[model samples]
Target: MTQRLPFLDRLAVPAIAAPMLRVSGIELVSAACRAGVVGAFPTANAESLEAFAGWMARLNDEAAAAREAGTAHAPWCPNLIMRRDPARVRAEVELIVRHRAELVITSVGSPAAVIPALHDGGCLVLADVASVHHAERAIEAGADGLVLLTAGAGGHTGWANPFAFVRAVRAFFDGPLVLAGGLPDGVALRAATVLGCDLGSMGTRFIATEQSLASAPYKKMLAASSLDDVMTTRAFTGLPANFLRPSVVNAGLDPGGTRRDGVGAGGAPALRRRFRGRRDPALGRPVERRALGRRGGRAGHGRAGGARAARGIPRVCIGLGFSLKGASETPDGLRGPRPEARRGVSLAPDFLQ
Candidate 1:
């Protein structure tokens, strides 16, 4: 039987660089692809679908050229956050299809709407599901593949054992499975393969690479700390995610304390009631991804959930900002068309490594 996702055979590494907002941009994507792995960026990072179209246009051209020139190349992907918002979600879906994105990583909700669009566009769809039940649902929803997020994963994660997770999913499905969590290096990559995973997912490790959009402090923290220094908090996005010690301290909260001092009185009651309905790990509640580096889920966009430019850390708004000029302010190589200055998000880069 033919597998739904045939792109795996073209990859040089059994790794899919996780789509990190702000951090995983074209520069990092291109770099990872050049390094023989699947590189991805979040569609949410683009200001609009038109911008995403342009971004993908350039990336597709590059990838095509590289392949033509005999350079080892892998497909580039963009993540789409599926939710109740039909308009926004449809726009993103249209962009992915129009751009012919070889892979689409769906997260935060169902893979229902976009899967047909992706299939029509001749693209592979991989849903970011934290549990086996979610994986089954995604598969039933027509996903071509699944990205299994186990415990200790950086973003919204499932608190399941990886071995158990693999076993549970393998029992019913044998399609393309990319295991995500803490696979940081070659050894971890080997282990995942041994566990029957076709591929490994990595996010933290790339946050330290030259191409990453992470600030100096974030990379430093990743290099300085070990797994012991990492902590999970629903405070960041209303979703349980692992974070670094420095970010916790910068947000003015005790890393060990789970209580939030400023939670709203009315909102807390509503949130509690909502959590009651979402007590099951599967179909988890939506975690609000905000910026500004605040602890806990908030709206907008800063450091609350998405990979954001670390506050108290230098912001390299070089390409996306005008009036900024410096070697350190520029992206890794300044190769492609000069991208506008983009905000640098701080992220711990060593969890997988």
Candidate 2:
């Protein structure tokens, strides 16, 4: 049942850059491709189809440049969130097909809008799934591959353990498998391989890379932050996402005060003029923290402008091979934990794409 994906086997690293909302831009995508891995971005980042079209053009041009420069350019992919937004989905899928994307990652539903078009265009389709049932449904809907998002992943993740999840999915489909969420480095990538995944899915790791659009602060935060620094909650977006512990502390809420109760965007803080400005219980104030977000007209922290604003880095590129700074200088050959543990008790917001 091994389904072969053409062009995917050419990667130097057995991993794919996760389609980060603000981090994955043309430069980052092209860089990832040149670095020998699949690069991806989400359609939600583009306000309109016209902008998406322009984005596609830029990405393709940059990728071509990388190809001519003798770099290992891999295929680029766009993530499509198929909800009730049929018209939007249709338009983005058209652009993806028209631009000759090598892969298309669809979430929240089947690959109905773009799967056939991608197939007709000879593109590979990988559906994101938080559960085994979703995986089966995607396969039945004719997906070429599956991204098994386990718990502790940055975004929407399933409750299944990574090892068990991968083993379960392997029992059914032998197609290209990518394990997403919390895959920070080469060590995690190797773990994914041992778990029977063809490609490891990395998102947060790229956020700290020199080629990334993540802000300097975000990159620095990620590099110095340990596995314990991340928290999963659906406070910002209507979905679950991983965020920095400092962010929650800045919001003036006790990270461990609230229990993980009730689903569907209920735990989110109510809209306020200013969020609490410090995680330290002692240093607290209702400070007018310049909030970052698209909905409220406030740019999300580190975003440059508009949705595209979310792509810029907030700090200088501080490459930490491992989660700890100065812990390991070697980026390529490190093997660490499958699940990086955090000792602190805190909660964080989740980014939805």
Candidate 3:
């Protein structure tokens, strides 16, 4: 079955700059959108509700100006955190609507709570889901799209292979689907479309770019890294996540273990750098070390912002071949599950006009 996602037609390439926390500010978001791909940032990136509102205002205003000038900008989507504090969530939803947001991404919780209000405001929603349970629940909750964070994804990633994940979801739901997991370049993006996903999501790839708000050191470190440097551990966020091994060492912690006590006596005592990377008890490493996360009142040893793939995606991935194909309101070259079917994800029926 074919699906419709009108926003995708506006993109020069079927890609998205996935939002990274503590990074991905106005400049990066705007840069990505202007480059003809959906750009997004987490609302939590702002210090407070007022700051969040300000970012929304600037983003919306700039986008409108670009469109007025006939620029190649796509829509700016804001990632909203809905995991805690009901009042804060309500307030956040208000701000999103007040600023005339085009699309909102709900993470860490269900989007059901804000769907009606957002729909009333003419805003679309995409839920970031890692499992089939979450995916099904999001659809039942009325999300307009699904950002499939599959295996190889950074921060709190899923273990399912994208092939299996996309196939299962496409069986029932068919909205604007995005496949996220180690998507670093155009070739990967092309693979996503061929695998039945509408968009290929890039988080670490975008973070490495200068346009991103990630720290300079982190960017350089990511640039020098390769797949062997990535370690998937549940130490930091309690969920399976990928991190740079060098980051763990820099914090004076071992990247081997994932216990949640306190660090060794030799560890940073003042700033209390507690990383999820634990030491092996058998290897004579201390076992009482707290892991990095907001839960249990512990913070990551440091802001070990991760980087994956090469840098400067918007600039480098422009003409590497394999651009999306549009024909008679249907996306060509989009296949489902090993090419047994020619089904693809696309905009609504009237999007071609």
Write the candidate numbers in order of decreasing TM-score.
3, 1, 2
Task: Give the poorly placed runs of model 2, Cα more than 4 Å off.
Answer: 66-71, 235-238, 256-353
Please give the range of 10 consecutive residues that has the lowest summed lDDT in model 1: 318-327
Per-residue lDDT tens digits for candidate 1, residues 67-120, read 899887888899886643678788888878888888888876787888888899
Clashes of 2: 22
| lDDT score, candidate 3 | 0.62
Runs off by more than 4 Å, candidate 3: 257-353
Q: Count the backbone clashes (under 3 Å) in each candidate.
A: 21, 22, 10
What C-alpha lDDT, on a 0 to 100 scale, does residue 231 get in candidate 1? 48
User: Model 1 residue 145 lDDT?
Assistant: 80
Give a tens-digit lDDT track for model 3, residues 1-353.
67767777789999888876756787898888888988888876677899888877887788788879987678888887666567877898888888888888887678899899999988999988877888888899999999987766665455677889999998888788998777766887999999889888777777657787766766666666555555544333233345665555544555443322122233222222343344433233432232332222222222112333435432321101000010011111111111211122111111101
**lDDT measured at residue 54 in model 1 versus the true structure, 0 to 100:** 84
